[model samples]
Target: MTLSREFKVGLFIGCTAIIVVLALLYLAAGKGVFENLHAFTVSSKSGDGFTEGMPVVFSGFNIGKVQALELNEKGIVLIKIKIPDRHVKWIRSDSAFILYRPLIGSARIVVNTTNLNSPPLDEKKIPEVIIVNDINDAIARIEPALERVTQIADNVERLTSNLSDPKGDLHRILSNAGKITTNLASKKSLVEMVVSDEESVKALNDSLKKLKDITTNVDRILTKVDKMADKTDSEIYGKDGALPQVNVILKDIVGKLQKLDKTIDNINKISSDTSEGTKDLHILRSDIDDTLKTVEDAVKKLDAIIGLKKAPEFKVP
Candidate 1:
């Protein structure tokens, strides 16, 4: 049953040809060769980004393909597009086609229809190919955002620069903190760290020592004052203290005051009696003065009556 070498070679060639035909069929089927297609033309200014059999997309779905590319006598390039009859309803008279050459992926021909119910597209009225460069759009979209990011980065860099500057507040504070920590770790006192001079430290220590001595002396004086106060309290308030003697002296003085009050009452009574005697003497003196005046008037009248008759004889005798 072994075949000849020539027959085997021909069999191999036929098998290879069958495989090639299947591949062609597979590729053509993918391009809608087996299905009915609706044809339309798209005129473009340039056909630089077009390819044959490229999928025509409608709303993210592949509905047709670019059938052929040609140039007319007026130097305008015409792209023939074939849409499946089933998808032809999506193409309206006012449908737009965009040749989107993206920055990241392969170029595509995109279809955008405003209304699915609109009149069917006419074959005579060719759709214009709108070229869109993704790179340019990307640059346009990214320019403002990139500028804002750059502004924010510049602010951050300035902040960092200020923070790191030797003359800045943050750096000065850190330097001070470092010196304080180092001084403390090296067993230098807080005053020593602040004053820097040993003589100042010695003077401060001397002053503190003098203050301590003055505090001790004040404490001793306060103790003595407290002892004196206790002694004074006992002397003034104890049972055998001067307070009881003072109370006895005060009682004796109160008794003397009562005797003096009685004596004062007796003296007031004697003054009243003496005032009564003086009033009687004043009345007796007034009566004696009246009697003397009457006697003198009678004598003056007797002398006037005797002087008429007796004076002539009495003068001779």
Candidate 2:
């Protein structure tokens, strides 16, 4: 059957419309267009040149976009972000937001929310600025420190080069080591000469053996002396000794004293007999005196009788 031009035109138009609708649906899904969105506000000193439609990434995946940016009367940048409601729970009170520009990449807004138990962020809340405050100021501050590090490295390199030079003190130390080695090699014969004196070595060994023998003899003498001292002490201090002989001599002296006392008694009796002989001599002297007196009296009596007869005896012869 032959198709009419009007009919063909209408069929083509219908198919084209269906294809366009499907493409729009796919793009909207990729942009999270069908999902419910929540608005959160962040305030910062500066925007760091971030514009509307800039992606806001959570843990490296895009979760939202910056929908608007404005400045308040205080000149602070107010950023309004639209985040899908499905990911809104990830935005907590403790979450950190930063705008970072690395040395190699365009600036980006990063969200970090490792703590899930924190309180949820409120709607239209002004979030804190977490990164990239002043890039130019930081670079300016680090220039002097980097220059100092570079200067220190250059000084160290110069010192090392000076130490390695052949005419320097390190080279003189190495040359002295080589000279010492050469001197030791040339004096090998002197070491041999010192080791060759066998006679002196033998004398030293003999002296040591003699000293050992002397020590052994001294030990034996000490042992003998200790034994002799013990025996001498026992003999002098034992029961029968000179002390008992002295006691016997003292007893004999007492017996001689008794005999001397009897001799003194005999001498006293002889003295008494001599006194009796002297008394007898005095009695003989008295007897002689009495006999002489009697003779004198007889003479006187004869004289008186002769006078009375005197005239008759003269005539006869």
State, as a TM-score between 0 and 1, how close model 2 is to the true structure.
0.42
Per-residue CA lDDT of model 2 for 106-216, tens digit only, reads 666788987989999887578776766356657788889889989998998877887888888878888987876676676445443344455666676799999999999
The CA lDDT at 114 in model 2 is 78
Give all TM-scores, in the order shown: 0.43, 0.42
Residue 126 CA displacement from its true place in model 2, Å: 1.7
CA deviation > 4 Å runs, candidate 2: 133-317
**Global lDDT scores for all candidate models:** 0.81, 0.72
251-285 in candidate 1: lDDT tens per residue?
75566556656655655665678866655556545
- Worst lDDT 10-window in candidate 1: 308-317
Off by over 4 Å in 1: 1-3, 33-54, 66-89, 96-107, 112-117, 126-145, 152-190, 210-317
What overall lDDT, based on C-alpha atoms, would model 2 receive against the true structure?
A: 0.72
Single out the weakest 10-residue window by summed lDDT for candidate 2: 308-317
